[model samples]
Target: MSQFSTPLATTPGIMLVRVGQAGCALRWDAQAACWRWPDPQGGQLYAWPAQDSMPSGVRLLESAGLIACCRSGRVLLGLGKRLGSVELPAAGQSGRPLQAQVLATIDAAEARTVISDGRTDRQGNFVFGTANTGADQRPIGSFYQYSTRHGLRRLALPVVVAARSIAFSVDGARMYFADATRGDIMQCAYDAERAKVSDVRTFASVPAPAPERGAAVVDGAGMLWSVQGGALARYDADGHPRQRIELVREPVASMAFGGPDLRQLLLLGARGGLYGLPAGVAEELAPGVADTPFDDGPAAVVDSQRPHHGD
Candidate 1:
């Protein structure tokens, strides 16, 4: 079931794409005409071909992009099959992608840690973190930045047991990250020009009962959106609570700002279901997603009805 606060009532325009187990890192692929996410339980990367079509599950290889801290698997920077130039069709057309090929593969992390949370910086370089997934959850994880030129360079920062809320400011001057058990969302000054981070401090503290949160996304207004406890909480750049809407009975598994003009707040509930609400902030268009001419997926069904998981 879903519950909405005053904020949800205020933003009545809703759009929904019925998908499930979108654990984190919801990305839009313009060339392939699909939305991509990693299934934490299934240990595979799944791609949804537009709003109304069926989802295509792509099996993971031995090594690739990583997430779902508990399990080990490969992820992706770009979605493909490596069979050479396979052009995908628009929605309702046949050639939806079922296999994901590796466009770029980076170096691996330490044996004890797993790649947990990550996102691209303002410059589009992959900035992610490793986490200690051992039973004791030791703080042996470190952050790393990867690019074609620099390859993979680890950052000089304190270790963490788990990583969440990995996001950046609009200008990429500030970075926000949190360890699942730490309760405090930390802020660090990011130097995109020099690829450095410093001035670490607490940005916001998660209260009891909602300490664990999902990955966060920054809106066009420079505010933050994260799934806290059983609802979606909004915070200002200075870390003040702006508003909160209880969309589900449990914490959300993943969320991101997608859809046309990047104004839709797409979130997957902890139990299961996908929901979208009008965010009203016209965000910066994602790489290749907006400039490239592709079929506009589908007009989502606008309503407050609870979304059900599909096959």
Candidate 2:
């Protein structure tokens, strides 16, 4: 395996896109042919085509924290304390107001909480993490999985102070999760069919002086791409550190591989706007992993189920 040495040259990323508000939960909507992200601060979901400066907005979700494109082509939104979906207006129908359909409301047991980061598994089940919004910054957040057959089932993991990134291996055999409070990223064996996770282990640990880690993604070659402070770090499948790509003085909140061939690395900055790096750098640093298509399965719940509150 190749190793990245210290003082690696900083390859400045270019600013390709900009959002009306700071964005998070950056994802590509293949069916819609645009990139989607939620600006919770702005209370709107925004979509922009790959080569366009004009971004369309949907004002349906209040505090739309995170977003995922469902198999049915609707957008799954994490609306603060609720899980909801909205059918995005087709091209040229941008003038109509999008309506949100609440699927589940997560109760926080008298404590303020909001759904944070989320993603779909290989089997198309939606998995999301929550964070305590109380002033105490308490470690009372939990993770849950939703499916048509199972409604919503909370996972067995320790309560986290702040849940950040969520990603899965190419084959869906492994799942990665990050807790920004502790600055630790953990990997566990994921059984997609049963919607179960096991053997939770540490994948990477970010130390002080490094900004808290955020969302992470697995490249085509199974390498993990995660944000560490102001730079993007590349890691092997097993969590060994490799190369680091320095950004243009902005902290990356999340990232995804997009573009027609899925080679472009789009980075979402915490301050606002988007950055792009040559797909070639990702390919050269982590070769052999094939692109894993986004899960576009329909988001469904048989019935509304009560979400378990963190103790």
Q: Any runs in candidate 2 off by more than 4 Å, and if so which? A: 1-5, 108-110, 208-210, 278-311
As a TM-score, model 1 comes out at 0.69
Q: Show the lowest summed lDDT stretch of 10 residues, model 1.
A: 78-87
Lowest summed lDDT across 10 adjacent residues in model 2 is found at 286-295
lDDT of 1 by residue, 88-177 (tens): 233455543334433222223345666667776776555677667678778876666644344455665567887677878877789888
Question: Against the hidden reference, what TM-scores do the models get?
Answer: 0.69, 0.87
Best by lDDT: 2
Per TM-score, the best of the predicted structures is 2
Model 2 scores a C-alpha lDDT of 0.72
Candidate lDDT (C-alpha), each: 0.54, 0.72
Q: Candidate 1, after superposition: displacement of residue 240 in Å?
A: 0.4
